[model samples]
Target: MSGLGDRILGLGLLVLAVAYGWTAQQWPEPFGGAEGVGPETFPTILSVVLVAGSLYLMVKPDPDAQWPLGKTALELLISLVVLVIYAMLLEPLGFVIATTLAVGTLSWRMGARPVRAFLTGLVSAVVVFVLFNYGLDLSLPAGLLEVS
Candidate 1:
């Protein structure tokens, strides 16, 4: 059963990687001048890596790997619920608060200690904020916090 599942996942990942690579290749380059890597560069590289990883897994899969069952399913369900709630509350609650709450709740559900989970989630939120706001120069909603 586990082997079958892994095989299916591997195949799906392979298809996704191919599709992503093709899509990336089809995207037009915004500018012609020599500068930083184009938008397609990262996606193409990521797709290649995904394809290679999926192929490796398909070729040499572990026999003893076991899929998580009931409790894990419940945990995933809880995490999904929290994520959806966070998305819904994002506009009103603000990015930091909503993201921290969502990540912390998901981490706790996945068996992390409360303090550790909170810290991890807070750190994750900060990292995401820096990456998106500063590194990528992309704007996210400030919501109630007014960070924007």
Candidate 2:
């Protein structure tokens, strides 16, 4: 329950950031020239920010940092599991369904009532789905909801 916890967490996050940035760089160039920003741009930027934060956390971690325990630890584990599942399900169940499930579970864990939390997740997911797919003209997989 000290800087050890923060150092460990920061190291783990730094590893993940490096892996993410490396994977992003593996993406092929877009159809048009490499003139415009490509698919890797945003992810690379995020990874860079993550790397910086992780470095800061490792270098000057809070000496009194305490890892979560009991209920809080359980909640964190549940959230992590949900996120992993959401990522796996995204392609098969589609963006809206996957996002709703992940967001709703997280919201409920954060103390929102089940009904309101789920409703909020559904509405937010649908809104983002529409915005990304239609407004931005970037298609999201329909998956099980795909039209024949």
User: Which one wins on lDDT?
Assistant: 2
Q: How high a TM-score does candidate 2 get?
A: 0.88
What digit string (tens of lDDT, one per residue) describes model 2 on residues 37-58?
A: 5668778999999999999999
Off by over 4 Å in 1: 20-46, 80-98, 113-116, 135-148
Number of the top-ranking candidate, with TM-score as the measure: 2
Clashing residue pairs, candidate 1? Answer: none
- Model 1 residue 82 CA deviation (Å) reads 5.1
TM-score of 1: 0.60
lDDT of 1 by residue, 1-148 (tens): 4466677778999999999999988866566653455667778999999999898878877677777789887777787788789989888876777888888888877789999998888899878877877887544566777844
Lowest lDDT block of 10, candidate 1 = 29-38
